[model samples]
Target: MKILVTGANGFIGSNFCKFLVSQQIFPRVFIRKNCDMSLFKQLVPEWKQLEYVYGDLRDKSSIRPAVRGVEYIFHIAGTIKGSSWIEFYEGNCLGTLNLIKICEEENPDIKRLVFTSSMVAGGPGTPESPQCEDTPSKPLENDWYGISKYYTECCSKKQTNKLPIVIIRPPMVIGPGDKISFDLFNIAKIGIKVFVSGTPRQFSMVHVEDLVKGIFLCGTHPKAIGETFNFAYDGTISYRDLHEVIATKLFHRKYGNLIPIPIPPPLFYFVGLILELVSKISHEPPFLNRPKAIQASASGQTMSNQKAKQILGWKPKFSKISALEHAGRWYQQQKWL
Candidate 1:
């Protein structure tokens, strides 16, 4: 089937494209003007199969040709590490709206739109309560990423009454080509023992390969229409346990020496606010006081993939250990470490 994948040069999108090619399905890629295409070059040799169109999702005119004759649309483009909420809104929310408009006007035949969303949309501040698809998006204050994704889903649902829309909420996807997990790997390499709140919060995670498989299934599976699926691992692991897995795989170290410090949640917020204020003026990502840390340590962010497994016949093959091993090997190949 001919498909159109937006943000095809990014970590998850590029990996998804590679996975499609392995299955002998080379979808057309819609890349932004400034996105680096080096990753695409390294992965696919026969570039002819991977048709790329230079377009910005925020501009409806540029996106029209890309959707022509496309059977499915994997709308995955968005800005994550932004310095301001405006960037997140324009890049993610408005961009998604423009894509929906293009699909409505240019390609009415496109029957499926598989949107990739984050688990943060459900707000990852409480670990005790596991979030499901029906939960309202109680996004934390200043959580632009979560808010933007939530609005994207809302806009897509409003536009597509006849077409099928499947939203996949993936939690902390880690694999061979991810930059977010690379930070953890780098920290582990330095023998810097990672520390977290003593409160054992669960981290719902999935391998990139497994997430891509879930997306492909959602694009074609009849039961997936008008549904939101949490494509996380079947089981949830503690933050400390996750760190230990990373250390063991990358550094070959035992789980000891990892520090677990218990700090009040309010204190973390105060410090984060201070850092954010400074970052706002400096135009930089806060190094020490990012809000993501509080969510990571205090929030459970645990989700059950039972629905996906039972409905879509999706099973995640890579365990946390396997994911780390593969990530380490990929880092070595790229000389990232």
Candidate 2:
């Protein structure tokens, strides 16, 4: 099968490419001209079998050649961290629309266009009540990332009649080569557990490997056409519990010695405000900002994966503890801890 994997140099995308190679499937990879190829180089050593297409999601003209004549297109390219909402919209919303347009015009033979959306796009559910595909999106006005992803989902649905498309919404993905989870591991390595507030926030997560498998299933499963599936583990974990797991895996000790520090919600908001101001002056995005602060302060953010399992025969292979241990081992090997 001819396949095109966009954003193949990113964390999940790179891992997906690696999975394809392991399965003896050589796929054409579409990547930005300025993307960092470090992860790709480390994961995929058999570059001779793979085809590379250089393009940007922002440029409509560049996407045509990449999408043309491909049986499947895994559209995973999007801006995850940005200095402003415009950047996220340009890359996630407008970029998705441009890709759909090119697929319609240039790739009529495409069997499936698997889109990678986020669970945040569907917004959050209460800790007691996990969200499902049927849940309505209540994205916060300040959560630009979620807004952009939600818009992308809407664009994909609008194009479903014109083209074959399947959307997979993955929750917080954890595994090797993941910088987002690595931050938490780094913090835990220092024996400090930082909480945004006294209130506990719940989150659902999936391992990168399992998420890639789910994406592959979405592309291949006949029943997945014109449908959206949430790809997450079976259950949710509190933020404090997640931190404790990371600390346990890293320190190999109980959580008693770990310092639990709580930052008031107001102080967290102030920090975000200060970072936003500095970002404006320096023209560089701060590691923490208003949108991130708002998300961190929110209490509930969980999702259900029953749809994916029932419809696509997909289930996560790693439990939370196993996933954390695997990530911790990788960090230790890389000396990231």
Which RMSD values do the candidates have, in order? Answer: 3.0, 2.2
- After TM-score superposition, what is the CA distance of residue 314 in candidate 2 from its true location, in Å? 0.6
**Stretches of candidate 1 above 4 Å error?**
125-128, 196-198, 259-291
Tell me each candidate's TM-score.
Answer: 0.89, 0.94
Which regions of candidate 2 are displaced past 4 Å?
272-288
How do the residues 227-332 of candidate 2 rate in per-residue lDDT, one tens digit apiece? 9999887778876777788888778759656688888877987887797788678754455677667777776778888899999999789987888889789888
Error of 1 at 70 (Å): 0.8
TM-score of 1: 0.89
Scored against the true structure, residue 98 in model 2 reaches a CA lDDT of 90
Residue-pair clashes per prediction, in order, are: 1, 0
Best by TM-score: 2
Q: Each prediction's Cα lDDT score?
A: 0.77, 0.84
